[model samples]
Target: MGAFTRPFFIGFRRINTYSLHSMRQFVLFIVLITGLVTGKSAYAQWEFYGAGGVRYATTEEIDTNGKPLVKEHGFLPGLEFKANYRRGDWLVTLGGEIYGGNLVYDGQTQSGTTFSTDTRTRQFRMTTEVGRYVSDAVLLLAGTEWDYWKRDILGRGTTLGMEEEYNSWRFLAGAQTRVLQASWSDIYLTGLLVVSSPEHLEVNFDNQVFDQANLSTKAAIGARFALEVRPKAYSNVSVESDFEWMRIGRSGDAILSKGGSPVGTVAQPEHVRKAIGIKIKYRF
Candidate 1:
């Protein structure tokens, strides 16, 4: 065992976070070795596991139908690596993970105007935590980390253009406990509370009426959770799944938009997302 053992974890959505992707690689590595060693390619004493994420966002358009004008989706790709070290009641977990993907949206309109845009999105994150043993099978963990991100928006036709940078101070505190220890595998559940600050240093479009830029920098608090199964002691394979909800800085009127005349009464409602995703990890 190297560090934090329970596969891996993830947190918050709206803005992309890097935890979930790292773990999937670890989970898959376990399965490949198990299949070769056991003669069966199916799940064995060692196994692999993961999940995928799908996100949706509502637009700023208002309607006589009382419906927001548009909606869109964001899909991200991520992976994880794990090395856990456990001594009876205490242990340390260290790992590195990366999330790479594109941010895309399809504008919904009350009228005939439909819009779409795509931007480059990427995040690199890593963490380390120390765990204090509570019981022979339980551990409480706490730690901190660093997260770096970059998002670029390129307008196609009538939409907006945005280029933003997000670098955050990441603080994590959490716990994991043994749920069941069976002959085949060990099951555990983990939860983490994360506090971070994301800054947007550049704005190219007006947040309100300008067709170029809109949206603000944000610092927020969020949470992450995961459930994992370890097939055997020192086994290379495992099964894990996770969920994360994140609130990035909100969308506010930019410098350019603030002074512009209200364009035909434009309105923006709150934007929220519930993302569920899956992935697989493989270790060499």
Candidate 2:
């Protein structure tokens, strides 16, 4: 009986050793596959980036009868900054931008009066996002953005001076992918969509201000496409070109009396905006 019991205990120890060894091998295999999926381990976790650019933005204001009341077009210089965090194949970014310019527009009143107005514009934008690489060269991101558009209409001599401001929040999604990659250079493409929430509007003229109290703001949509070129792998400098377009639904009262009184209701003015720009960015 002692000999049989000793052999049974020895077999149980062998089986336990084999099971532990197999478990270790399985865990190591999983680690190897995870490393491959992430591409590389994170080294630098944070980066700061800045950009400067020139933008040509076009704006149009339409009257109730669907006729254009004003078409403002001009070029502006802009600046932007970003803070970025990277881990494995994922990145998070926070950014802000601002631009201002002057546009000239020819206006025709209902009485066939032709006049010109100088429209000065200022815009501020803020954004936050998280992005992940779906492939070695492709990335997708979803984000949120806030935008403030301010327009000041100055008189061209005897005309009236007015101001219009629109503020909105947007839901954004986009994709970025490499278009060309070589030893000397890399080219990338990026596209974006922005859908705005209910906007807020403020208008001021002749010492009177009209805003959310008496006016309604509508939704807006925007799209943008950009191209980026990196000249060297070791350098953090890049050249970029962007084109964007936006359209906003009707806003404000079409018929505000000369006395600033609310008159019979008319269709609100519609807004359309388009822009193209080139920029340079440095990352550290």
Candidate 3:
């Protein structure tokens, strides 16, 4: 509840601009599904929850001109919403999240001059999954995930600012296991593996352009766990603490361009992202 709150609000506000009509349709679809389920059964299995968390991206080092370089680290504040529906042994899950942060980049010039710039970063992800319970406490799922990222670098002196954007997709498979269950509390652990591909990646350096040339598919690995406590019977209210970790692959190719000609290529560093926080949820 400091400077990060500003970006948290900004991220949610920008969601419509990011997906527009698609998001509206998605929300309506979920509403319709919820209505149908409630109308059909009194013991309906449906859950809607929202969470807020803090996240950190691993440090990265990148090269620049004249033996100069930069190292970046990102601290993000995030919010997420998830919906789940279960009938018999089959379950469907839909979720989305937004993260916004300032990426601190420390740079060193060839002449040994050092400086830092705070680059703004905004990211969003959507996920859908279909799963079946293999046992009372174990579930296996497969899903598709999509991510969008944007970064803005502030100009310093004669250096022109840059805006970078990326769209990515992943096919994922995962399993969830309940580690502990009590009358009023529960614990769950989940692990996932994904094959990720970049749909688009580009950089606009004050109008000069750099685009992805030949991108490579990469693997992403993730895990998350949650502990929840319910306060009363027949009540959907609960408080939970969630922990998650993800290791993502490289940032793909960035082909430098000048006057409509390819000049050089840029190398990007890999990323490891992690988040942990407490959230309150209500199941319906």
Candidate 4:
């Protein structure tokens, strides 16, 4: 497998430590804000919901030369939960989801060697947002989201596999509108623009635990869209379909290390992910 199997691992122990701390702080801040907002009015309206769905996700990594190096795609079952509080024209919402499955992996090396395997994948996402109803049918929102993903490629004969982990934070601004309303049903549409920062990736080769590489932080932009339908008959039930797309720019080169000693330089290629899902939710 040549370089593809040559134990390319990225070490991010210190960085991950700092990131975890920051993430905790952010979560705490969100909780504090939520408490403050909701405490103002004992009569604030509250809604809670849980959802289950299946998602199809595809991820691709490109080479420095802009050629595709690896592709992984799969369907995963997932669950989501959310809580919303509304007072007057203001809204506060917190939500999260977890999903994972085995993905079919296809990869090709620069020297034309090819391989196929299965990759175990897991992902989690959390979001907090505040919004205001601008009109009877329109709402504007701003939010922050944290995303985490991990993949473990199974080794094949004479070939080594590796594990990759990624973390990122995103800021989003969006608007939602009730597109259609009737006595029996309502349909809503939402669109969001997202900006991501401090993208981090860590890699570990199964065979060479001592070798590592670091990908420099890069910013990315993405978008999300959702369409939701609520049936009057059920009153508190809704179904939603959503799509998300993101691209992480190619990272700058960093020193590769073996046993804490610098060996050479390596850079992470551009990465892209796309996902679509349908979910049914029940609210109380």
Candidate 5:
């Protein structure tokens, strides 16, 4: 049985037959892959593997009328980590990463009417998973993220600092199917599903008096294609693709208004998005 095992099931990730790009839950899928590949406190050998690569990610606006609003692109950097125990075909795992792509947009409306500063897209991830082998060529994983977020308007065009933050949980599941295995090349097909809470965050404007509440939740489904090549000893390269579609909404009305007056508090704004990305990583 190799090192990893099959994850029983996770609904957040596979919300039907939809593609990952339609879900917007790519990071959870990534954690699923990292944990399982290194599973086995009982079934795997204590080992560490990593890789870094560059990729392209695109986000498009989905019209309420069932059309695409705008298309955008970004450049990205990615890394992978694995920690697990080995005992046979069953293994437990833990892993995480930080990744983001430059934000590319078209229509100004998509950027938000309250937009005062230019924002780009970025992401951070932390998670743990478990897997067991059902067959030599197939591996399944199930896990949850302690925290995850997709941030926008990270920094000024030249400075690299983020001012806003979002908080949420992620439930994920995935399957990896080995298509080819050669001394020089390895290829696999990966499928994933992710379900998340609407992310709510606090933004402190330059003035300390204005406190903005950013509360929302989202769910997405997606898939990926992975290609790996071993060109030399002690090194390997991996390229991956991600696609997702998502529905996001506030848990409750953000604020209450009475007679045109700000009264009570409820929730935040609601929106939907679809995105796709391709990335590469080097393993050492």
Candidate 6:
């Protein structure tokens, strides 16, 4: 009886040892998998950029009769900042810009009266985008943007100053690709198709009797193009040039209000804007 009991205890000990060894191997496998996942996640990084540049912008508005009403053109100084986060094949970007300056305004009233003035202009823009890398050199992008613009027409002699404000939203789809690769520098090109909608315009007459008017415009399609160059020695610096064009359709007539009473009807005419800009950017 003692021999049989001793052999039974020995068998139990051997089985316990085998179970411990297998459990250790399983724990080791789990640790290795967790480390690999953590290492892959650690590869995600953020990049920031700041830029200053000059933009040349031009805008033209036509009346309902297809007669030109006003044209404004100027060179505006601007500053922009951007941030990007990249993880594996996905990228996210956010950016904003502001531009302000005095512009030359030429206008002709319905009575064939022509006048010119210096208009104080300011523009603000915000953008967000998501991109996916399809290849080493190509990326596809989708984005949305918000834009605000204001113009203050300075009074000339007896005329009173007037103020105009515009708000617009846009959705965009784009593609970017590396066009040239060299030892010192690389060049990239991008093109975007944009759709603008839910645009609003407000006009203040600066008169006690007339007050203000608000109008909503039709949607439009636009496009943007950009070219960028980066130097290998200065990986954190780049130069970019871009062009954009957009048109806003005519708005339905709206009632102009004075106090609590309706004074008259006002409508925003069709307008087109074009801009070209260049900037040097520093990234970190």
Residue pairs with clashing backbones, model 6: none
Candidate 3 at residue 54, lDDT?
68
Model 3, 26-68: lDDT tens digits are: 5675575556556645545776666676666543433323232
The residue-by-residue lDDT of candidate 4 on 1-284, one tens digit each, is 11254444211222346446645754665465456555645544877677899899998888768778888898988887777888889999988777889988887643457878877887878899999999989999999999887777777765666666778899999999999999989999999999999678776656575464446557999999999999999988999999999988888877767788887666667888899999999875
The TM-scores of all predictions, comma-separated, are: 0.59, 0.77, 0.70, 0.85, 0.62, 0.82
Error of 5 at 4 (Å): 49
**Residue runs of model 5 more than 4 Å from their true location after superposition:** 1-44, 59-72, 105-117, 150-163, 206-209, 218-245, 250-252, 256-284
Q: lDDT scores for all predictions?
A: 0.51, 0.68, 0.60, 0.77, 0.49, 0.75
Indicate which candidate wins on TM-score: 4
On a 0 to 100 scale, what is the lDDT of residue 262 in model 6? Answer: 79
lDDT of 2 at 284: 56
Each candidate: how many clashes?
Answer: 47, 0, 0, 1, 53, 0
Global lDDT of model 1 = 0.51
Give the TM-score (vs. native) of candidate 6: 0.82
Q: Over 4 Å off in model 6, which ranges?
A: 1-44
Residue-level lDDT tens digits of model 1 in 90-176: 777665555667756555322445555655666655666788888777778887766655555555443444444445676778888
Candidate 3 wrongly placed segments (more than 4 Å): 1-45, 62-71, 107-113, 207-235, 239-254
lDDT by residue (138-238, candidate 6, tens digit) is 99999999877877776554444566677788999999999999999999999999999868876666443355567889999999999999999999899
In angstroms, give how far residue 261 of model 3 lies from its true place. Answer: 3.6
Give stretches of model 4 more than 4 Å off.
Answer: 1-3, 7-44
Indicate the worst ten consecutive residues by lDDT in candidate 6.
1-10
Give the per-residue Cα lDDT of candidate 5 at 71.
50
